[model samples]
Target chain A: MASKVVGVREFDSLIPLLRDRGYDVIGPTVDEGTIVLDHVATSADLPIGWTDHHDKGTYSLDKRADEAYFGYAVGPRTFKRWLYPPRQTILTIEHAETGLVFKPEPTADERYAFVGVRACEIAAMEIQDRVFAHDAFADPHYVERRARSLIVGVNCAVAGETCFCDSMGTGPECTAGYDLVITEVVSGERHEFIVESGTDEGETILTELDGRPTTPADRKEVRTIIEDTAASMTRTMPKDETYSLLTENLEHPIWDSIAERCLNCTNCTLVCPTCFCSTMEDMTDLDGRAVRKRRWDSCFNREFTFLHGHAVRFTTKSRYRQWMTHKLAYWYDQFGTSGCVGCGRCITWCPAKIDITEEIAHLAEQTREEVAT
Target chain B: MTTTVTRRPTVAVWKFASCDGCQLTILDCEDEFLSIVGAIDIAYFPEATRAERGGPYDLSIVEGSITTVHDAERIHDIRAKSKALITIGACATAGGIQALKNWADVDEFAKIVYAHPEYIRSLSTSTPISDHVTVDFELRGCPISKHQLIDVIDAFVHGRKPNTPTHTVCVECKLRGTTCVMVAHDTPCMGPITQAGCGALCPAFNRGCYGCFGPSESPNIEALREAWHEIGVDDPHLVQALRTFNAYAPEFKEASETYA
Candidate 1:
């Protein structure tokens, strides 16, 4: 709960310290021309001095003047992959002499300390937590992984072009759902991190760092940085009205127009932080050893709605509508929260540059016109 | 649940008008080939063995397309003899790149390439084996995936369905953690419309997928064309990308024709 000001070097030392404490440090690194979440050894492995320019269907990494480690917005990947993997074996079956023996996948014991996690991503994780861990039939693997993982979140210094976290009431600042949170403040000749501990484990790590108490000036700077980020965000969705707007407009012509631009590529859902739909695959080898794998499936796929040997949603219009409506509207009925975290990965990574915020605005505009009539 | 052991299932491989790549994929299963031989009888495979056995075969794996009158008739004969006929590769599944002749005059092409056009007794339009006879299953790709080929064989030997996915290449890219080329670098990719089988190869290598694997289950080509246009990929390039490998696949052929 207490905030402390640590030198940039002290902040970098946390990686090795976490590693020493039996945590695999997962952090943001430049890989294949984009910032990606990967196995990070030290702060040097982090995308130091790198800032990414993100817009509708465009992303390019650029070097910043300051050596800001967490300068960029969220990249193609999020903390979701670490928590809920793209593909994982759920069960394995073997043919025994007497009968067939069934075995569930062993619960993973490896602890992960995810570094440079974004605020919106934390919100996405919380949404997934409710899906996998809080349900009546909780996923033991997800529950175990979530329990063991330590989140080291970073407050955004710069808002991405497609980001609308401020409007979603999820970000620009690391508000909750982090063990430890950092605000990188670079002013004049001094470079420091205003770090705060949210849990006892975080407190223990913070105390070990031996950082000085945050002065009023330091706290003021962190606030200014967060405020500036919020101000920088230009793209926004009308979050409060999203539920009713999407639910009410089932037959709206806007979906047809959106479908024309949408490729139904599954890029948006795959890159999205909170899209948790999956399909099961049963694989049997020649030896009669069978394994059942749970792979990430997208609602954009025609087969996602298959029933009675026929696809329920056969057209692009139906699939896209289901994806967007389920994310913005029907998710409230099912999960009591909006599926979208406003991270803007879907907008940035869409080959068609289909902006969710723009689509919502269009729906809102059409609704206003109907009301006026 | 117990079935008595009888004669091993007999298999025959047939080729008509393709580059022997798909048959090579059968050979490419070097590790599985020995076990495949142990499980089933390779009754007739001209590419692999000298000895030939007559069918009344259990399963016949066909490659290539019906580009010639003789090959077209031969496919019907093979279908009648075989209990189950599985077509493999883009050639057998969707008529391959040679089906581009469907858009052009085959006689004109023959006259230009051949010394004597009269000597070439070819059909007007190259068509898939399914056009001539009943096909049990179709394994799709430019050259079919080795793992999938093995799966098809194993599934046929045992009475089960193969686990070949009909999802887009975009799904494969995400599963493998490859960043989308079109999104990251403005590279126009056909992965959104193309089927998953090549493991999203081109995008993983930082290049756009040229779509060697054909259209996905629901190929939204018009939308992809628009998306490609936004990224400065003109109509000509989009059309060319669609008219490759699996060019004559109904979904791709229709989209390419619209563009043309």
Candidate 2:
């Protein structure tokens, strides 16, 4: 039998059914002047008619369609919030009249059936899975949260202005590591979901949905949708190998240009889903019962690379250089993967308005000129 | 939580001249942390406890730089107390981000990061722990990797050196099958100079490495500088690159001074 298709009318019914199967449906909607993920119930909660034009640290919103879920790509936040919470209570210490005992807090109690997860985010999930869920020193909380979750991946219809996913070879389309892949098609009367299944869990869910079986025409339509989305991408990667060229130019003078405006606030690290830099602090109550807490940190801070009361990357230029290099170069060594997934959160949100794409292009132009010499 | 072993090893975490991020990476061990703490009796973690457990510590993890006269004296005291001393992060091993003070006027550096320069007491240059005393092992990163930290600790407990690679991050990029950002995009990066540890993060993001891991084994820095110059890296930024966490490490220091 061919796979099924659920109409716009039938879509609302699917949410409760998904919840009945223990899926915690999360998706995008306009919040606080930006698109954000929240508890989406009705299909109306989706950011249907809204789309955004994002450039280096600049974004402008517009209303394109009457429907709520048209613009699909990466957002500032990710499932990192679920797997690795911002402020997790690692352990709790209680002092009894008798003595003192340390107690570990329990891991996440809720499992989410993530809805509308972008392809890049899915890849990000896989990368994070490797880091936090390994046998070497397994993170039980991450394992538990990631294990029971169901992901519904989406193909991108709109790419970020700063996005370079095509360069990393990771996304703009849903490929793997997700239960169900959905492509949103909106041409004439078609605002439908063209689904593909990557796992048995997705197949099982597909079996439960009451839509008609997918046909050859459906496959063709899905293919056309994804291809069109990929073609619409405005950003292009450079023509040559990225790592070697970058690794060969450690002393390049381009950093000073970007550093001129770079604030070194470390917001780039804060919004980055993969940036795992952090620091610890101690709090003592009035009674002097001390408790410890760890917080998210950024390499952009002068202290991040400080030693012996000295600051490495003291100049904003060096700090800028360090952050970019590690994001593009050194992360490969640590994880056997590129630390950045071309999410573009850093580019759009940076207070400095530095565009990685433009900076790289300038370098490429310079290299081209040098080659002629 | 594990009562199976009675005499757990005593673990102590120390800091010198840093913002305390490397030690925080240890705390970020989050879930495995309880078990690690269970495995070790945390002796003298000023950031975590007021217990003030004494030393002859089974293992001591040091973070930050040795920039002050007191810190020079303090490292020796720490060495006497620690059975194994492992320096964590770029700050501790490479003199950290603060090592920028090593190059410029000390008075200027003091004015840069702090509100009142007179309020602070520090040395003219930030130096690594290895400069002052012997370090059993050193882990790299502006903020050290958690898995690497565990590996170093595990190796110490098992009586061996941690198997961290000494090659450049470029090797890691090749292994990961990443498209070179510099050659393809002509983007200047530091993957060649920096050691492998951050998993080639920036390159994956379609950016370049800024030498977060410190200088690699036998860094061909001059060759890299020529490539950078050919690639449009300017002189001022070149000076900035060699002045990072591991800036004062003789090789990078020499390279930066040569360009300057």
Candidate 3:
């Protein structure tokens, strides 16, 4: 995997090249006063010279000092929006002359090339791949879309205030689960990308670009930028201790305090890249036509744990505990890896400003107290 | 087609103390109105037609709240007559905006608003239909979504439960990929505690949701209040916000009382 140096101007051709290669390229673009993952026809559609500031319950877009294409932290949207849509029609039923007919809904089958994908997001995708793709009863929709899609990983150059990827060992560096990985380097009066191919397809696309052999200076700049992003992260979760600390303290008093501020809004779960839960709904029209749709569900929802004509997790404390435990503890038992990639979308997007890293720290502190006693 | 004498399920629309917005939602179902009419017999819909038929109704779609003693008595009678009574909109489900009068002295407000307060013959409180009689189902919203209204009727006619979700507006916002106004713009939004029937309307336009669809199932109003407080919305403002459309809804009512 030899890395190549692509000049800022040459990088402009990347999106067009992906489009020409028959991909519906989705990249970051400014929308609704924030960077959003949307259709990218050319490199111009990228959130160039723009970055986002992320903190608990806050995200604001700001102008960057340099014209760096991949300068921003992860936005509200992730690649999950495409691979695992919030709502999807799984089956459609219509009345036929002979009898009622049930048919599987047709999927779009578009080849997707997602650009500007962060390293933590790549980790989330791998976690989802285990859930939706590797399982015995694999979801055809997710499997098909995932197989057809290509990921272009972007190593973080700037860490958000809520980010704790370095602590989680997910990354500020693009390590794996990518077809092509890139690191945008911006020096005074110069902007370029050091790119490497993780797959043959990525190499083919890289060959099409006007790139030169990477120099030592380019590699050194990429390393420095990644290291800086890792260093800048102010938030940290005791990642290894989260599982035991959360699972053991099932009835922690801290949960009640957290619940006091937890809105049960489902924003955290909805914005999370790895949180995957869905519920099916059958919609019927007057005309004998019924469609069953699978929409995203969250543990924070009261009805999410409904059983025997009543919700099991009736309190905010229970719901919040369920979500946090499942994300940090139960997820390890189920998927062999932590559900949280530490991308921090959950913290940033939470309307109540509930921080996962902070909660985990509280749990660790409480556990330490119990052990001392 | 052979003419069959099979009687359709008799449908009736009843009103109490609302703005007729929920009933108007029925007429707003322009494309489906005729089909709905064809499926069920509109025995008593004074808003749409002059024809008035007494129930023994198969389905009674009730709108508004029991604002007066007469309306309160009338709801019990309507409930007894109808096989299934479906309460529609905020007025029928959670007492609507007029329920703000529940907290204040109605007579005092009437004296200020009316020339002769003595002329007004109303109850002290505006209460939802459920407060008086057993309501089979309730479709909550200031003005109920037309699509959901149709679903209620369709489900009633077909003998099934309606598909209206009782989740928070945040679920709908996420489903539609609308950015959180409170999180992204520092706007005070009630979407976290508000129900999803309006399809997350306000937040889509970059405006905070005003809880027009009423408090969601098991809504955490206290949590929302604390969140809003952090964003500069004080207790008074939070109380005022909760006292909107679904003022008398137990969750909002209790939360507002705490703040008040």
Question: Better model by DockQ, 2 or 3?
Answer: 3
- Model 3 residue A327 distance off true place after TM-score fit, in angstroms: 1.0
Tens-digit lDDT string for candidate 2 (A144-226): 88998888888887787767776767777778888887777676666676666778888888777666667788878877766
Which candidate number would show the highest TM-score if scored against the true structure?
Answer: 1
What tens digits encode model 2's per-residue C-alpha lDDT throughout B109-170? 66887998998887898889999999988898888887777667655544544657555665
Q: Write the per-residue lDDT of candidate 3 for residues A246-286, one digit (tens) a residue.
A: 87889889998998888889999998999899988877766
Q: What's model 2's TM-score? A: 0.58
Task: Give candidate 3's iRMS in Å, 1 decimal.
Answer: 3.1
Best by lDDT: 1
lDDT of 1 by residue, A1-373 (tens): 8779899878878999999999998999999899999999999999999999998889999999989889899889877787899888999988776677799999888799999888998999999988999968899888999999999999999899999999998998889989999999876787888899999999899988868999888888888999999999999988889988988999999988987888888999999999998999887665456689999999998887888889999988999999999999888888889898899999999988889999999889989999999
Every candidate's fraction of true contacts kept comes to 0.61, 0.00, 0.68
Question: Which stretches of candidate 2 lie above 4 Å from their native place?
Answer: A96-99, A287-290, A307-309, B1-260
In what order do the candidates fall by TM-score, top score first?
1, 3, 2
Report residue B11 deviation for candidate 1 (angstroms): 1.4
Docking level of model 1: medium
Tell me the deviation in Å of residue B238 in model 1.
Answer: 1.5
TM-score per candidate: 0.97, 0.58, 0.96
**Residue pairs clashing, model 3:** none
Question: TM-score of the A chain in candidate 3?
Answer: 0.97
